[model samples]
Target chain A: MEPLINVAPYTGWVYPNETIFEWSVLIAVYPYLTGLVAGAFTVSSLYQVFGFERLKPVAHLALLTSLCFMFFVPLPLLLHLGHPERAFNATITPHWSSAMAMFGYFASFYVALLLLETWFAYRPFIVEKAQQRKDLLGTFYRILTLGSYDVSDKALRYDQKWILWLAIAGIPGAHGLHGYVGFVFGSIKAREWWSSDLMPVIFLFSAIISGVSLLAVIFVVSSKLRKIPIDLACLKGLAYTIWGFIMVALVLEGLEFANIVYKGREGVEMIMEYVTGPLLVPYFILQFAIGAILPFLWLSYMIWRGTTGRALIAGVTTCACLVLFSVFMMRWNVVIGGQEISKTGKGLLSYQMTLFGKEGALMAAALIIAPFLVLVVLTRLFPPWEDHAKSSSSLRSHA
Target chain B: MKKVSNPSLAARRSFLSKLARAAACTGALAGAGALGVGVAKGASAKTEAKPAAEGGSFPTKDYDWTKHQWAFGVDATKCIGCLRCVEACKVENDVPRNAHQFRTWVERYVYLEGEDRARIDSQQDPVNIAASGSEKEYRFANRYKDQKVDKAFFVPKLCNQCTHPACVQVCPVGATYKTEDGVVLIDHDYCIGCRYCVQACPYGARYFNEEHGVSDKCTWCYHRITKGMQPACVEACPVGARIFGDIKDKQSPVSLFIRNNRVQVLRPETGNAPNVFYVGIDKEVN
Candidate 1:
C-alpha cells in the first residue's frame, strides 16, 4: 500500500512540513485550461466585434471550442480539493479578502457569457434545422431554439446585435478570468519566483498565445479530418496572431526572470543553484529553447518567405503544438518550480510526481484531453461549419 | 411582408414578451434566495457561542480569550538540543509520528573552523532520524562531534502566530482565522482543503493534515493556553529555553523576556509582525 502523503526529499534546511508538497500537477492544469478558454474566445471576438474578415472560417469553430474548454475548466480544481462536496462553501459564504474566493463568481459569469454568445451565433442554424427535420435530433434542436423561430431579416439582425455585444462583454470576462489566475500566484509574497508586479501581464500574454495556438491547431486538424480545403488566408491570420502575441509573452517572461536574478534577494543563492542545477532541462531547454524560441523563429521565417499552401499548413500547425507545450511548461515552472525551492532560503525540495493517483500526471493529461473530446461532440451536434453559416450572412459579409 | 401585417404575429410577440418577463422574474427570485442563504450563514457563524471552559471542557473554565494577549519567546542560548520539547509536542498535539511533519522542532546550527555559512540541520535531518532509530522517536546525532566547530547553538522553531497572518488572509472559505487574543485557528469542518493557505504562508508553518483533510499548524496549544496552562513544549523544556505568557500582565515571562532583552522576531522584512520574539539567535537563523 502507498503512503497517504508523498514526502519530498530535501537537500539543506527546508521547514519540516515543506517536505510534503501541497499543490500538485493538477493545479498546473487548471490555469492552462483557463488560458485556452480565454484565447479561443479572442478568435471568436475578433470576427464578431472587430471584423477580422480573414478569420471567418474559424469564428464559429472558435466559439464552440471556447465553450467546450470552458465546460471542463473546473474539473482539475474540483478534483484537487480535499473536500469536493464542500466546494460550494466558497461561493455561498465567500471570504471577501482572499484572491481565490472571487474565482467562483468569475468562472460562473464567464461560463454564462460563453453560453449566451454561442446560442445567439447558432440561432439561425438551430432554427433552420428545427424547421427542416422532424426526427429526434430535430426535436433536440427545436427545444434548443427556445421557441423563438423568428428567423426573419429583422430577427436575424436582432440576433446579430446580441451576438456582437455578448462577444464584446466576453472579451474581459474571459481574459479577466485568466488574468485573475495569474494574480493568485503573483500576489503571494512567499515565493520569489511567483511574486512580481509583471506576473499578471505575463500570464495574460502567455494565455493569449496559448489560446490562439490551440485554435490554430484545432482548425487545421478539423479541416483535414473533414477533407475540406484549408483556408490559406485564415491560417495566415492565426499564424500572425501567434507571431505577435508570442513576442510579448517572451519579453514579459524574460523580464520576470531578470528581475528575480537582478534583485538577488534573500533566497537568490538557492534559486540560482536550483535553476542551474535541477531546473536546467525543464526551465531552460524544454520551455524556452525548444518550446518557445524554435516555434517563434520557424513562424518568423515562414512569414518572411511568404510561405503558402501545404508549407504554411505544416509550419503553422507545428508552431501551434510547440506553443501549447511551452505554455504548459511555463505553468509548471511557476507552480511546481516555486514549491521546489523551499520557503527556507537555505534548502531545495524536489517534487516527486506520481503516475496513477488522483493528482497524478495521468490525471492531468486526461483533464487536458477532455476538452478536445467535448469539442468533437459539440461540433457534431451544433455543426459550427462555415458552409452552414449561410443564415448569418452579415458575419460572412464583414469578412 | 405578409407576416408583418399578420394579426397572429402580434399575439405571438406578446407571448414571447411575457415569456421573457417570466424568465427574468425567476432569475431575480433565485438571486435573492442565494443572497439570503449567504447572509444567514454569516450571521450564524458570527453568533455561535465560544465553547466555555467548564468542567473538563475543551477550553479551560473562566478563561476569557479577549482579555489575554498570548505571546511566545525563545532563548536559544539556553537550549541544549535535548529534543524533549519536540517529543512532548508530538505526543500532546498528536502530530503525525514521522520525521517530516513537525509542529515544533529544534535546529542545530554549526559553523565549523573555516566555513562562512552556518551548517544548519534540524532533528528532521536524515542522520538524526537514523540516530533515533525510528520515526516515532526523536534525537540529534553526534555526527558533528569530530568536527572543529567554531560555534554552535540550538534554535527551537514553531509557528510565530503573526499579527497579520498570510495563511488566514488566503483561506478561500475563511476556514483559518485569527483569534481575538492573538492566535490563528482553523475550522476543520469548513476548510475546502484547496491548500491556498499552505502556499501563502511564508514561514512554512502550515501543513495539510492528510487524515483530517484540513490545513494544520501550531496554535500555541490553544486548548491548553485558554485553560490557563502552559503549552506542552514550554512545560517540557528542561532548560527554561521556551517561554509562554500573556503580555497583558507586565511581569509575565514573555513580557519580561521582551522588556529585559534585545529581542527580535524572524523575518521582520515580511511585514507579518510576528508575535513570537526571539533572543540569542544569529543573523543566519532565517
Candidate 2:
C-alpha cells in the first residue's frame, strides 16, 4: 500500500527506501526508556553499596523507578517490529555476531537482577505488612513473601548482605544494558553520526543524567503529594551528581562532534548540511542549549551556594525536568537524525512522525506512561517507603 | 518371616522396579525409532540422487546448491536509460507498485563539465523510448534541453549481494543470509522485521516489504537462477547491459567481461566486497 503522505523531492538521488526511514520514532524511544532504567538503577546503587547515607531517602525509590521503567523498555521495540509475534525468533535463534541479538539476553538478565534485588530489599517490610493487616491486602503481602515467614534479625542481616552484593553486580549489568543500546547504533559503520567509539560512553553518562534528574523530580513531586517535608540533603547530593555527570556527557559529545568536523571525510559534508539544516532545532536548541547548557548553569549555581529551601527545591526540580527532556531529545537526534541523511552523500530525507499509526509518537508516550503506572501498583504491593515511615514514628513516640 | 511381615514395603519396591523397567524399554524403542528415521532419510537421498544422475529434470528438493558462485555485471556504457530491466524485475519479483518498494531501479547521472559532483535522478519507470521517436529526439524534447551535458549515462541499481554483507551480520535472527552459492536471500517466515538489515546495508538496496511485513531485497532472482534461467533483469536488458552468470565458470560471459574490462564495485571503501561488477562506471556515480 502507498504511504498516506507524499514525500517531498530533493535534488540529487536517493535510494527509494531512503525516502522512508524504516526505524521510526518508536526506535528512538526504546533507548531513551532503557537509559532511564539504567540511570535510576545506578543511582540506587550509590546508597546501597557505596555508603552514601545522604542518598538513602531516594535509594529504594530509585530501584522501584528502574524496575518500573524496565517493564516498558521492550514495548517500543515490540511495537516497532514488523511482526511483533515473531520477535521470539530473535531469542530462539539469535545470531551471536549481531549486536542486537544480545538485547534479549541482556534485558532478561538485568530485569531478573533488578527484581531479585528489589524483592530482597523489601522482604522485611512485606513480612511486617503481612502480620499487621488481616485482610485481602495482607493476604496479598503474605503470598508475595513466597512462603518464607522468617523476619529475624539474622535473616534481615542476610538480606542486607545479599542486597549489597546484588547492588554491586547491578552496576555492570546496568552499564551493559544501556551500553548495548548505544552499540546497536554505534556499531552501524554506515552512518557517521552514530559510528563513534565514544557512543557507548556518551549513552551511559547521558543515561545517568536522565535517571538522576528523573529521581529528583519524582522525589520532589512525591514529597508534595504526600504532604511531607522535602529531604533537602538528599536533594542537594542528587543535584551535585547530576551537575558532574552532565558536564562529562556534554564534553564527550562535544569531542565527538569536533573529531568528525576535523576529519572532514567524504560523508562529512552531507552530515554538516544535515546538522545545519533540519536538525538545527533539536540538536542545537533542545539538546545542547536548553537540555544541557541551561541545566548545567542552573545546577552549578544551586551547588555553589550549598543552599536548601523551598525555592532551591523548585529550581532543582525545573533543572531536572529540563535535563530529562534534553537527554530524550539527544536520543531523538541520534536515532532519527542519523536516518535523515541519505547514504548517497547527495540528498536529505525528512521524517514526519505519524500520530495515529501503530508505531507513532502517541504509542511511545503510552509506553513511557505505562511504567509509572506499574510503579504505582508496585508501591501498593511492596510499599517502598513504609519501613522508614514506621521507624520515624517509633522514634517520635520514644522521644 | 520379616519379609512377609513387611508386605506393603515389598509391594512398593516391586512397583518401583517395574517403573524402571518400563522406562528402559521406552528409551530403547525411542533410540531405535530415531535410527530407523535416519536410515530412511539416507536411503531417500540416495534415490533422489540416482534420478538426477540419469539426466532427469532437477527437482527443487534434491538440487545440490554448492556447485556455483553467482555474480552480476553491468556495462554502464551500453545502457540507454531504457528501464525494461526495471519493469521486468518488478513484474517478476511481484514488487509493490510504490516507487519506494523497488527491487531494482535505474539512476541517470548527469555530470556537467567543471562540476565536481554529478547531479542524479531516477524515475519509477524508465524513460519510454518506444513512445518517443528516437533517442536523440527524446533527449532533445524531454531531457538536457537547456543544460550543458558533459557525460551522462544510466547505472542500474540492485543488491550488490556482498560477500561480507553487513546486512547478514546485523540480522539478529539468521533471517537474511548468504547461501553457499553466493546468493543473499531472506527467509520471510523467519524475519522478525527489525529493519536492522535495512539500516546495515550501505547501498540502500534493502527495504521493509510493507505488504509482506518483512525486510526484502533483490535475491539475484534466486528461483529463476537456481532453475538455470537468466535473471528477469538480465533477460530484459535490450543492449546486453546487464549480465548474470556463475563466476566460478571462467568461460561465463560475466567472468570473461570482468577479466577483459576494467570493472569497479560501488562503495569499495566499505569493504563489503560486492559480487556485482560495473564497466565504464564514472567516478561521479556513487
Candidate 3:
C-alpha cells in the first residue's frame, strides 16, 4: 500500500506539519468542474432567458453539458475526503459559521435546478421518442418522461415558459454556486494568496469564460461528428460570449494579483518568491500568456477580419480549447498555489503529485475524462442537436 | 437594617453559592450539547455502537469543565530543545509516530553573528529526524554545534486553542469545536475528514490523522487537564519552560506568568485571539 500522506519538500522555515499538504490536486478539480457547470449553464441561459437567437443551435447541448458535468462535480471532493462514508455528516449537522458548511446545500440545490431545467428543455424530445419506438431504448425514454406525455401547443408553450424561468433562476444558482466555491478559498484568512475580496468575482468571471468556451468546443466537435455543417452564427455567439467574459476574467485576476502585491502583507515576500521561482510557468506563462492572451488575441483577429466559413470554425475551436486549459490553470493557481505559499510567511513548499494513489494525478485525469464519457451516452439518448430538436417541436405543432 | 454579626462570612457564603449554581448550569448545557451531537451521529446507525460520545462530559465523571478556563504558557528562553515535550505528547495523545505528524513540537531559531534573520528548523526536519534515527523518536540535531552561535532559543509549539479559533470556525460538521472550558477538540467519529480546518489554521497546528481519517491536533491534553493534572508536555519538561493552568484562578502559575511578564501570542494579526501565551520570544517567532 502507498503511504497515506505525501509530504512536500520545502525551503526556508515552514511549520513542521506544513510539510504535508492538506488539500491536493483533487481539490483543484472541484472548482474546475463547478466552473464548467456554471459556464455551460450561462450559454443555455443566453438563448432561453435573453433570446440570443444565434445561440439556439448549441443551447440544448449547453444544458446537457451542464447537467453531465454537474453530476460529477462532487466526485473529486468525495475521493479526497478521508472518510468518504461520513460525507453526509456535513449536511446532517452543518456548522453555520463555516463557509464550507454551505457546500452541500448549494450543490444540491444547483443539481436539482439543473435536472429540472434539463427535463423541461428535453421534454419534447422525450415525448416523441416515447411514442415512436417500442424497444429497450423506448423504455428508457418512457421512464425519463416521468409519465408527462402532453405534446399540445399549450403544453409546449407552458414547458417553454418553465424552461425560461428555470434558466433565469439558474443564472444566479449556477454562478452563485461557483462564486461560493471561490468564497471557500477567499474566506480563509490564513493564506495571503487566497484572502482577497476580489477572489469570488475573479472566480465568477473565469467560470463564465470556461463554461462558455466548453460549450464552443462541444458544439464544434459534435457538429463534425454528425457530419453536419457547423452553424457560423451560433459559433460566433459563443465566441463573443467567451471574448466578453475572458476580458473580465483577465482584469479581475490582474487586480487580485495587484492587491496581494500592493498590500505586501507579511507573507507577501514568500508569495513573491514563489511566483518568480516555481510558479512562473503555471501562473504567468500558461494561465496568462499562452492560455489566455494568445486566445484572446486570436479571437479578436478573427472577429476583426470578418472571418467566416471553415477558417472561423477552426479559429474558434482552437481558441475554445486554449480557454479551457487556461481556466484549469486558473483553478490550479488558486487552490494549489495557495497551499504552495506556507502560512509561516517565510517559506515555500512544492507539492509533489504522485502517479497513482487515492489523490494522485492519474485519478485527476480520470475525473476530467469521466464527464466527457457520460456526455457521449447522454447525447445519444437525448440527441440534443438543433435539427432534431426543430423537427420534434414542429411535429408537436402538427399534433 | 437588622442587626447582623459576622457579616463577612455571610457575604462569602453567598458568593460561593452563586458560583456553584453557575457552574452547574453551564455543565448541564455542555452535557446536553454533547448528547445532541451523539444522537445526530447515531442516527446513521451503520457503525457499531461505541461508548458514549467521548467528547461530552464523559471522561472523569466528577470533573466540572465550566469552573476552569484552561490556558498554557511557554517560556521560550528556558527551553533546551530536549524534545521531551514532543515525545511525551505523542505517547500521551497517541499521535502518529512519524516525523511529519506531531501533536506538539519545538523549533530551534539561530541568529549567527553577522546574520539579521533567524534560521529556524523543527524536529520534523530531515536532518533532525536523521539524528533521532527512528520515526518513533524525536530530537533536534546539533547541526549548529560546530558553527559560531550568536543568539539562539527553542520555542515549543502546540495548538493555541484560541478564543476565536479559526479551526473550529471552519469545521464543516462542527465535529471539531471549542469546548466550554476553552480547549478546541475533534470528534473523530463525526468528522468527515474534509481537512478544511487544517487549512484554516494559521499556525499549522492541525494535521490529518491518516490512520483514523480525521483531523487531529493538540487539545492541550483535554483529558489530562480536566482531571486536575499538568499536560504530558508540561510534566515531561525538565525545565519549567511549559506551563498549564486555569487562568480563572488569578494566583495560578499561568496567570502569574501572564501578569509578571510581557507576553505575546502567535500571529496576533489573524485575530484568532489565541489562548497560548509566550514570553522571551523574539519578533521572528510567527
Candidate 4:
C-alpha cells in the first residue's frame, strides 16, 4: 500500500496550514441544530397534537421553543457558505440528484408550516389579550390577525382545529426535516461509519429524546418560576416516552458499530483511529456512559418508583446531558471523525479546530445560543402559562 | 373594396385566370413546406433527448476527463526526484506557505517493520522562487521523525478531477459544474456559501475561498489549457513525470501515455472516473 501517492509524487502545500477542514465544521452544525429544532418542536406538539391534557401547561412554551430554533436552524450553514446571498438559488435551481439540494424546499415549507401552527395556536389568546396593550407586542399580534381580531367561540374552535390538524401533520414534516440531515451523512458511501442503515433510525430516536427532554426541563422550570403546580402526569408520561426513545437510540448506535466491526472493511482500520485516538473519550465516556447510561438509569429509577419530583429532576438532568452531549457529539463524530481519515488510508490526518475559521467553535456557540435568546423573548411576549390559576388570588391579595 | 375598371366578361376572365394560377402555385409551395416540416420531425427522435437513455449527462462517462485530462505519466523506471514541477506550481499558482495546501504536491512515506515507520521530510518546493516560506517555515506535515527508516517512494499530488466529483454531487447549489471540455469549474457567481462540496471532495482537493465565500478547487489550470500553454507544473517538471494533453485527442501527449501504458485510475471503485492516470499506482492510494 506504499502510501497511495507513490505515482503522483507529493510536492507542495494543499492550502494554508492554518485552515484545518473548515467545511467539515459547517456540515457538523447544520444537522446538530436542525435536530434540536425538530426534537424541541416535536416535544411541544405532543400535548397540542396528541390531546394529552396534562401537557397543556407547557404546550405553548414548546411551540415558542420550536419557533425560536426553527429560525436559527439555518444560521450555521448560512454563515459557513462563501456566498450566502445566493443560498436561495439552491431552491430556485435545484439539481434533483443532490440530496442536500432538497433542503431548501423542505426548510422553507417546514418554516411556513411551523409559523402557521405557532400563530393559530396562540391566535385567540392574542385577540383577547391585545385589548389591554398599546405596546409593540400587541401591535404585532393585531397585525398578525390581519385586521380581523375575533374571540368568538366559533372562531376559537376554528383556529384550534386548524392548529391541531397542522400540528398532527407537522410530526412527519419535522421528522423528515431532521431525518434528511441524517440521510445526507448516511448516504455518503465515502465514510464507513456514516454509511449505515441505522442512521435515520438513530436520528429519529434522538430527535424524540431531545425533544421530549427539552420540554420536560422547560415545563418544570417555568412551573417553578410562576409558583404554579407542576403537571406530574405529563412529566411521567414524557419520562416514559424519553426512556423508550433513549433505549432505541442507544441500541441503534450499538448496531451501527457492531455491523462495521463484524464485517470489517478497509475503512475499519481508519475508523479505529477514533477508538485509539482523539475521539475515544468523547465517544466512550461522554456519549456511551455518562450521557447515555447514567441518564437512562436515573430516568428508569424514577419511572419505576412513581416519584414525580425525582422523575422531573432526572428528566431535566437527562435533557442537560442530551443537549450538552448527545446530539452535538453525534455531529462531531460524523463531521470531524469522518474527515480524520486520509485519502491515502495509510493513517490519520491531523485536523484541529481553529478559533476564527468560518466553522470555528465560536461560530458554533453563537448559533446554539441565538435560539435560546429568541425563545426567551418569545416566552416573555406570549407567556404560555400566563393564564394559569395564580391570577385569581393575586388580585385579592393586592386588594 | 377595390374597383376594377374593366366590366367585360373577357377582362374578368383574364383576372380570374391569373388569380387561379397564383393560388395553385401558393398551394404547391405550402405542400412542399409541410413536407419539409415532416422530414424535420422524422429526424427529431434520432437527435433529440429521450428520457429512456441509460444515462444522459451524468454518472459521467465514469472517467474524469478534466483533472486527469493532462494525466501525469510518472514512470517509476525513470529515476530522478527533482522538485522542479513542485517549484513551478507553487510559483505559478501562488501556493500557500505550507506543504499541506498542495496543489502540485509530493510526499515520501517509509515503512519499516522492526524499526519505527519513517517519513522523509517532503522535498517541498525548494526553489523559493515564489519566496514561499512562512515565519515558521510552515511545519504542519506528517513526516516520520529521524527514527529507523525503510522503503520509501515519492508521490506528487494534484487534482484528479474525477468524472464524478463528490464535491460537485454534494453542492447544494449548482454552483460547481464540469465544463464541456471536461474541466471542472466553479461558477463563482452562483455558488452559495455552503461548503458541502468542499467537504464532499474525497481528494481533499476542494478549498473554500474564504475571501469570496465559495468553494474554489483546481481547474487544472484551465486558464493555461485554454491558451495552448501547458499547466505551469507540467511545463517545469525536469523528469517529465507529469504529462499534460488531451486524452480525447489521441495524438496529444496524454493520450499517447494512456495508449502506451497499462495505467490505473485511482479509486476506480469510487465511480469517479479519475482522468488522472498513474502507470505505477499503489493499490491502497484511495
Candidate 5:
C-alpha cells in the first residue's frame, strides 16, 4: 500500500529511506512511562528502606503508583513493535550480546520485586479486611491473603524486615528499569542526540523528578477529593526532593550538550539545526524554560519563604504539574528529536504525529490513561490512605 | 509383588529412547539436506552455463564460502546515474515499489567548486528517470543553469554488509545476522519487528517491510549469488560499474580491483568495517 503520507520535505541530502523514522512517538512514550514507574518506586524506597519518617504519608501511595505505571509500561513497547505477537521471541530466544535482550529480564525482576513488596506491606491490611467482610469481596480478600491469616506481632515484624530488604533490592531494580531504557538510546552511537554516557544518569534523575512530582500532584488531588487536610510537611519534603533531582538532571543535560558542542562532532551541525529550528519550542520552551527552570525557581522560592497552608500547596502543585509536563516534553524531545536529524549529517527530517494510527497520539494518550484507570481500581481495593487513617484512629483511642 | 519385573515400564522407556534418537537423526539429516540443496543449486547453475572456453561460466565449485569471503566494489567514475540497477534490485528481491523502499539506489552529487558540501538528490527508481527527468535538467530548472560544476558523480548505496554490523549487534532476537559468506540477512519469521536494528544501521540501509512485518534491507542478493548468478543490480549495470566477486579468490576481478584502486567505504568513522568498497568516492558522500 502506498504511504498515506508522503515523506516530509527535507533540506540538503538524506537517504531516501531516512526520510521516515522507524521509531516514533510510541517509542518516546515507552521511556517516559517507564521513568514514572522507576521514579515512583524510588520515592517509596526512600520511606521504606531509608527510614525517612516524613515520607510515611505517601509511602504506600508511591508504591501503588509505581505498580500501576509498571503494569502499563510494556504497552507502548508492544504497540511500537511491527509484529507485536512475536515480541516474546526476545525473551525465549534472546541474543545476550544485545542490550535490548536484557529488557525482559530486567522488567520481570523489577515487577516481581514490586509485587512482592506491595503484598508484604499490605498483608496485615488484607488479612484484617478478609476477616471483616463475609461476601464475595471477603473471598477476594481471602485469596489476596494467600491463605495465611497471621497478623500476629511476630508475623508483622517479619513482614517489615522483608519489606525493608525488598525495598533495598528494589532501588537498583528500579534504576535498571529506567536506566536500561536510557541505555537503549545511549548505546546508539549513530544518533549524536542520544549517544551520551550521561543519558542513563539523566534519565534516572529526571525519572525521579517526574515520579516525585507526580506523587505530589496525586497526593494533593486525592486529599482534596477525599476532604482530608493536605499534608503540608510531606508536600514540602517531596518538593525539596523533586527540586534537587531536577537541578541534577538539568545540569547533566547541560553538560552533555556542552560536551557535544565542544567536541564539535560530525553530526553536531545537523543536531544544532534540529535544536534551533524544528525543535525550538519543545526543547527550549517546554523542556528547559518552563519545565525545568520555572519549577525549580518556584519551588526554591516556596522553600525559602517557608510558605505553608494554601500557598505551599499551590506552589508545590503547580511545580509538580509543570515538572511533569517538562519530563514528558523531554522524552518527546529525546526520542523524536533524535530522529529529526538525518544520519547523513547533511539534512533534517520531520515527523507529524498522526491522530488515529497505531503509533499515533491517540494511542499514546490511551496508554497513559490506562494506568490511571487501573490506579482507581487499585486504590479502591487497597486504599493507600487506609493505613494512615487506621493508625491515627488507634492513637486517638489510646489518648 | 513388589519384586515383580516391570516389563511394560521397561518397554515404554526403550520406545521413548528410540523415538528421541530418531528425532535427532531426522533433524541432522534435514539440516544436511538443506545445505546439500544449496550446494547443488550453485553447481547446477554453473553447469547450465556455457563451458569456460566460451567465457560464460563462473567457477562456482572453486569458490567455497568456508574458504572464500565475498565482497563488492563500485567504480563511481563509471556510474552514469542510470537507475537500471535500482529497478533490477527491487524486481530481484521483491522489494516494495513504494518510494520509501529501496534495496539499492543511486545518489547524484553536484559539487560547486568553492562550496564545502555538495548538492545531492537520490532517485528511488532509475527506471523512471525519464518521468522524473535527469539530475542536470532538474538542477537547471532550479535556476542553477549557470552554476559552476567542479565534479559530479553517482554513488550506488545498499547494505554495507559490515563485518562488525551494528544491526546484528543490536537485534534483540538474533533475527538479523551475518552469514559466513559475508552477507547480512534477516530471518523474517524470527524478527519481532522491533526496528532496533533499523535504528542501529548507520547507513540507513534497513527499512521496515510493512508487507512482511519485519525489518528488510539488501542482502547482497544472497540467494542469487549462492546459485552462481550475479546480483540483479550488478548484471543490469550497463557500464560495468558495480563489481561483485569473492575477495578470497586472489585472481578474482574484484580482488584485483581492490588491490589496484585506492577504494573507500561509506561512513568509515562509524567503524562498521563495510565490505562494499567504492572507487573515486567523493568526500561529500555520507
Candidate 6:
C-alpha cells in the first residue's frame, strides 16, 4: 500500500511524573486489534466446524475478514520498530519464549490457514469459471485451480471435509493467537496492571465480544446492501453468542481486578489510582457503561421483546460501542494507568494528551485507517458474500 | 598437595580438577551455537576472568572515579527545609518552569487547616527562602502549622541510571546504553524516535526529546564526564547536597560518603538496580 501522506500525529501530552516517551497507546493499539481479529476468527470457525447453519452465511466472510485484518496487525509494531528493516530477524532468529517473538510463527500459520481455507472454499467457483473461456478471467481461475480444473463432485467433498477440519483446528489456534497477544502484556512482571495471567483470559473473551458483535452488525448491513432480507434466525443466534461472551467478558474484567485487590500485591494499591482515580471516568463511564452495559441492555431488550430488525440495530450499535470503547480504553488504560505510580512508589503522576507531529500520532492514524482501506479493496475484488452462489450457478448453467 | 605428604589427598585434588576441566569443556561445546556478547562457560569464563589486570594500573581497573559519576545524593534528614537542588537541576536541564512538570521537587504532606482531615500533596512551585537563602532557600512555614513547615521532608529526585537499565533492555535498536564508565546515555543518531525505552524505564527518567525526534534522559553529562568534568546540576548545588563521582572507586568522596552513609536506591524492587542512592530516602517515592 502507498502510505498516506500528511497524516498528522494526534495531540498527545506528557504527565509530570510520566516518562518522556509516549509508548503505551501506540504500542497497545496493535495488540488490541489483533485480539479482535483472532476473536472473530474463532467465532467463524464455530459455524464451519459444528455445522451451525445459522452461521453459514458468514463462513466465507469471517475467513476473509480474518485474512484482511491479520495482514495489517504486524505493520503497527513494524513502524514502531526502531529499525523496521531488521524486523524480519524476529522470525529468522526467533525468540520462541517471548510472547512478542512467537507472533511471527502465529502470524505465519494463521495466514496460511486463512488462505488455504479461502482457496478451498472458493475453488469450485474458480474451477467453473476456468472451464468457460480463454480470456484473462479464465486464465486467472485456471491458475487458481493449478490445472486440476475438473469440477468433480469428489473433489468438492474432499475440500469441504478438510475446510471443516481446518476451521475446527483453526478455532483453538485463533484463540491461542489472541491470548498470546494478552500474554505479552500479562507476562511483563514489571508493570502492575498488565502482569496477570487472567489478562489473556480477559482479552480472549473481549475479542469474542467485539468480534462476534461486529460480525452480527456487518452481516445485517451487507445483506441489506444486496437487497437480501434480514436473516432473523442468524440475528437471534448471534445475539445468544454475544450475550454469552459479553457476560464472560464482564466477569473476566471483574475477576482481574478482584484478583489483584484480593492478593493485595504491592503495586495494587498504587494502581487503584487508576480504578478510583484518573482512569475512573474512562473505565466506568466509557468502557463499562457504554461498551459493556448498554450493549448488553440493548441486545437483551431485543432478545426479549423486539423483532429481528431491532435486534440487528442494537447489535450494530453495540458493536460500534464495543469496538470504539474497547480500543479506546485498552489504549487509555495502558497509557494512563501504566504511568500513574512513581517508580519509587512515592506518589501519583499525571498525563494530558499531546497532539502534534506525524512522528507519533500520524503513524498510529495510518495504522488504523489503512486496514479498512484494505478491507474495502478486498470487498471490491472478491466480494466475500457472493462467492459460493455465483460460482455454483455459473458452473451449472455453462451451456 | 593435600597435607604436604599424603599421596591419596594429592590424587583426589588432581582428579577433582580434571573433572572440573572436562565438565567446563563439555558445557562450552554444548553451548557452541550460542551467540553474542560475554561467553557463558569455563574456558571462556577463564578467558573472561582475565584476573582484573595483574599490575598496578590498566584503563578502568586502576582509575580513581568516585568523584565523577556518583552525582547528587540527598540526605532527607539534613535537608534543612531547602529546595536549592530542585532549582539547580531545573536550571541545568533547562526544564520548562512549569507547576506540574518538575525535573526535581519537594513533596509536602500537611495536617494543616484542621487536625481531623489530614491531607498530603506535593508542592512543585516551591517558595524560596527570602532572607538567609544559604541552606534555607525553601521554607514551608506559611504552608503548614505554627506558621512553620508541617510534617514535611524535602526529598530531592533525579534519574537513577540503573545497573540493569530497563529502558536500555526494551529499546528495539539499542538506542539507550550504559557507558563503560557506568553512566547511562541515550544515542539519538540510531533512535528511530520510538519511545519503548521511555515507557520501559522504571524511573520514568527517559523522555522523548520532542524537539529532536528522539528519546533523551539524564546522561550524567557524557560530553562533560568523559573529559574530566562534573554535570551542570551537580556543580550548581549550593548546599553541597549533590555529590557526583564513580561508585566503583574506594578512594573517591562518593564511595566514602556512600560507605559512611545509609544510602538507599529509590525503588529497589523495580529490578532496575538504580545507581543513584539517597542517604535518607522516604517510604513513598516513585
DockQ of each two-chain model: 0.32, 0.29, 0.34, 0.20, 0.31, 0.13
Residue B48's lDDT in candidate 6 = 28
Cα shift from native, residue A10, model 3 (Å)? 0.8
Q: Write the per-residue lDDT of candidate 2 for residues B1-286, one digit (tens) a residue.
A: 0001111222222443454465653423433433343454345444432422132322243445666788999999999877788778777887765656677877888877778678677653124333344321222124665778887888988999999999999998767777667877787766899999999999889988776678888988887887788999999899999988998899998999899998999988888999999998887676
For model 2, residues A1-399, the per-residue Cα lDDT tens digits are: 545232434434677667667888888899999999988987889888787778878888899999999988988999878898977556544666799987877887888899899888777677778889999999988988898878666677777778888999999999888998999999997787888898999999999999999999988888898788888998988998899899999999999889888999777888888888888889989999999999899888877876679878988999999999999999999998888877887778788787877777788888888888888888767655634545311211222
Q: Over the stretch B178-201, how does candidate 4's per-residue lDDT look in tens digits?
A: 544566677665677676666566
TM-score of 5: 0.88
> Candidate 1: misplaced stretches above 4 Å?
A393-399, B1-61
Query: For every model shown, what is its TM-score relative to the native structure?
Result: 0.93, 0.88, 0.91, 0.79, 0.88, 0.72
DockQ, computed on Cα atoms, for candidate 3: 0.34
Question: What i-RMS does every model get?
Answer: 6.4, 8.2, 7.3, 14.6, 7.2, 10.3
lDDT of 2: 0.78
lDDT string for model 6 (B86-160, tens) is 555555665444333344555444444445322434333223233324321333445443443335555555667
Best by TM-score: 1
Give candidates' CA RMSD values in order.
9.5, 10.6, 9.2, 14.3, 9.6, 10.8
lDDT of 4 at A340: 62
Which regions of candidate 5 deviate over 4 angstroms? Answer: A2-6, A386-399, B1-64, B125-130, B133-146
C-alpha lDDT of residue B111 in model 4: 65
For B1-286, candidate 3 gives per-residue lDDT tens digits of 0111111222222443454465653423433433344454344232313222222325655665567888999999899999999999988888878888888999999998789999999999889889999988888888988788899999999999999999889988777766667888787766788999999999999998887788889988877776688899999999999998999999999999999999999988899999999998998999
Please give, for residues B33-118, the per-residue lDDT of candidate 5 as tens digits: 33443454355445433332222222233444455578999999999877888878877787776667777888888888798677
Please report, in order, the local distance difference test score of every candidate based on alpha carbons: 0.85, 0.78, 0.84, 0.63, 0.79, 0.59
Candidate topping DockQ: 3
